[model samples]
Target chain A: MTYHVHGVSASGNCYKVRLALEQLNLPHVWHEVDMMNGATRTDEFRKLNPNGKVPVLVIDEKTTLAESDAILCYLAEGTPLLPDDRLERAQALQWMFFEQYSHEPNVAVARFILQFLKQPGDPRLPDRIAGSYRALDVMEQHLATRTYFVGERYTVADIALYAYTHVAHEANVDLSRYPAIRAWIERVRSQPRHVEMPGVDQ
Target chain B: MTYHVHGVSASGNCYKVRLALEQLNLPHVWHEVDMMNGATRTDEFRKLNPNGKVPVLVIDEKTTLAESDAILCYLAEGTPLLPDDRLERAQALQWMFFEQYSHEPNVAVARFILQFLKQPGDPRLPDRIAGSYRALDVMEQHLATRTYFVGERYTVADIALYAYTHVAHEANVDLSRYPAIRAWIERVRSQPRHVEMPGVDQ
Candidate 1:
């Protein structure tokens, strides 16, 4: 049975799952969750995921998974996206955790506040921008000497961060200074079967 | 070679690795890092982990892993702390992510700001407490009818959240209302080979 992913493509958290599915060539159907409305907060959506967050991956009929990075780990298991080497696997997770704790909270949330929430003047914007740059600096330094986040090979670590990072410009996080990150973004885009977020890349 | 864990006992994120090590019966040594000072920002620590976060697990002196949840996953591999079933493993990770994304940033940060950072009157206190309570509400609802975070078994999911949750009171986010969470905390504490944060118990 094919997996059913419930989330909008605009969210990096959601886009990570979509990117993993495409890279792994997994069959899945997308069910968009209208965040602007109270769609995800409804009782039906709550039953699928108690947290009421988007990007819920429903496997078969009974099994369902929440948390985009965890879903990426699940989908990329045994595939080249998730490294088989023990240290490499842990390193991938290290970057994934960084993406969630450090990177996404800054870039992804800033993008949401800017693009989706349409609150450019929000007081929180300043801190988010600062946080985004801090996260980006870490990535830039790491990518300076490495091709991918974890190993030299492309993996879900790339997919997880790439979803929000490549579009951080919308959040006013200027990438002009991050030459390594810019080059890495181009490398990610050149990957096979790459998919773009809706309303982006035509 | 035994693993060398670097971080102080005061941090919940660091305590998570210590808990997993003791529970899994894995032999390891502990080296405390003075996070309150500038220890984490030193050149040596940065080499250990670029992000310079605590709970760095050095395996066999060659493979070092950072990120609390990721280290838990690494140490718990092939052990009962991580389920063998595919879906269960994903579910384990799902809660781990929730702990990091939803739980830790709220209460843990609040605890740091209030107890460690020592800024109880800080403007961010109210929001952190509110966010912590919101995350607790989700956990309370889920645990109302369940024994553990993922499935009925005690797993890394429990370890990840319990590290901060059991000590949330330090942040002034009272848990007197969350009876389910209170009960679950007792259950976790009663597990075999249960461990406590350093300096807390004799």
Candidate 2:
């Protein structure tokens, strides 16, 4: 049976799952939801994910998974996206956690507020921008010596972090200061079967 | 070489790494970093983790892993904390993600502000309370039927969520409204070798 992923096209959280699916060459159907219409808050949709979040993946007949990182790990297992060495795998998950805690909450939240909520001047904006740069600066320093977030090989850790930091400039978090991060982003984008943001005019 | 974890006693993120180590019966040295003294911000510590975050796990002579969830996964691999079933493992990661995105930011941030910053009426407090409850409500509903967060047994996902929600009330986000969540918290704590939050004086 074909897998089904329920998500919005423009959501980076959802895009993470889509990018993994594309990279894995996994055939799946995309069921688009109009998040702006509160479609995810509906009773039926909440049944699939009580959190009312997007990027729910239904596999086979009996299994469904939520959380983009979970989905990424699930699909990437036994594949190149997950490292074979245990220590390297741990490093992969390390960066994934960093993306969730430091990167996503700052960069993604800033973008959400600026682009979606149109709250560029929201009192929280300044702190969010500051936090975003702090996170980026950390990433910049780390990437200065490495090509990927984990081992020498590419892994889903890069995917998780790349999902947002690639477009961080949209939120006005400057990337010019981070030359290595820019190069790493380009390296990630050049990977085979890479998928750009869903709504962008490619 | 013995594993070494650099952490602060009061940090649940650090506690998570400790708990996983204990559960796995891994012998390790605990190095305390006084965040209150700005120990983590030192150049020496920053060299270990550019992000200057707590819960850095040093293994062997050259391998170091950061991020609590990532450390948990690393130690728990080949153990019961992680499931072998593909879909079940994904479910475990799903809860880990929920803990990060929905649970930790609210619970941890609120606790940090109220306990450390001493700013109860801080403009961010109200939203933190609201968001915490929203996440708790979803967790409560999920636990209404399942004995654990994922699979039929306890996993790292539970450990990840329990580390924070167990102390959430200190932030004024009541779990009383979510009876199932309250019960599950007890169930997790009841596990053998379970470690209470550091400084709890239990």
Candidate 3:
């Protein structure tokens, strides 16, 4: 059965699902949500995701899943995209949680403020940017010794973090200091069947 | 091998690890970190986690895992606490992600501000409390028809959310409005080997 994805194209979180689907060559249909026009906030969208967030994976008429990383785990379960070793799998989850808690709220939110909201002077920007750099510092240190986030192979953990890190410049978070991250970003881009994320309309 | 966990007992994120370890009957040692005293900021702690966060699960001298939810997944793997079915497993992860992203930041942070920092009037509290209710609303809606977060049974998803949710009062976020949530909290508590979270020294 084909999967139906409800998402905002320019969003890094949504892009993560698309990237995985393309890489896996999974049959799917994408329906873009007009997030800028209050589409996600509507009653109809709430049925797809009570959280009212983008990137909802509709497995069937009766089953739907929200949260991009969880969707990633769902799609990548039996593939090489997910590791088979128990400890390696947990390590992958470790980075994904780190991304959601530490990285995304800072980097992705900063990007939203600058790119979507167009509020460079937003008082929250300072802390968001500072937190973005701090998250980057941790990623850099971890990536310094490894090719991938876990077990030296491409996995959903990489997809989760790569979603935002690749577009961090939109967040106005500089990446010149993180050579390892730069190398890893290029490596992710070079993966088989890799697809580029659609840029946000400025 | 026994798991060595470095965490702060009073923190809900840390408490999640403790609760899972206890309920699963897993052999583990807990090392309480003095987060208020800048213990997590020290060089030694950084060696355990470069992110400088508590709830580090050290599997061996060479391996360590951070992020409480990831640790929970690790400890719960192959057990009833983690679902064996793929979709149910993904659903478990969905709620776990929601807890870290939507629930903990609001409920746990507000509790930290009030109980630990003693900042009842902190400006961030209002927004945090509001977000806490939003997260609770989602949980209450989900739990209104189900016995647990996933598969009608206790899982790490419940543990992940129950951490801050049970003590939301400390965050100054009232739970009286959420009957479903209140009922689910008791259900979770009734599970075998359940342990009470140690209250903060307020």
Q: Best candidate, lDDT-wise?
A: 3
Give per-residue CA lDDT, model 1, range B71-156, as digits (tens).
Answer: 99888878888887777888888888898999999999999898787887899889889999989999999899999988698999
Q: Candidate 3, residue A196: CA error in Å?
A: 0.4
The top-ranked prediction according to TM-score is 3
Off by over 4 Å in 3: none
Residues A86-115 of candidate 1 have per-residue lDDT tens digits of 678878888989898998898988888888
Error of 2 at B44 (Å): 1.4
Give the residue spans of candidate 2 off by over 4 A.
A200-202, B200-202
Q: Scored by Cα lDDT, where does model 1 land?
A: 0.89
Q: Which parts of model 1 have CA positions greater than 4 angstroms off? A: A200-202, B60-62, B199-202
Clashing pairs in 2: none
Model 2 native-contact share: 0.93
Superposed by TM-score, candidate 3 places the C-alpha of residue A108 at a distance from the truth, in angstroms, of: 0.4
Best of the candidates, DockQ: 3
lDDT of 2 by residue, B59-134 (tens): 8666678888888988998898999888887888888888888888898889888877778889888998899988
Report the number of clashing residue pairs per model. Answer: 0, 0, 0
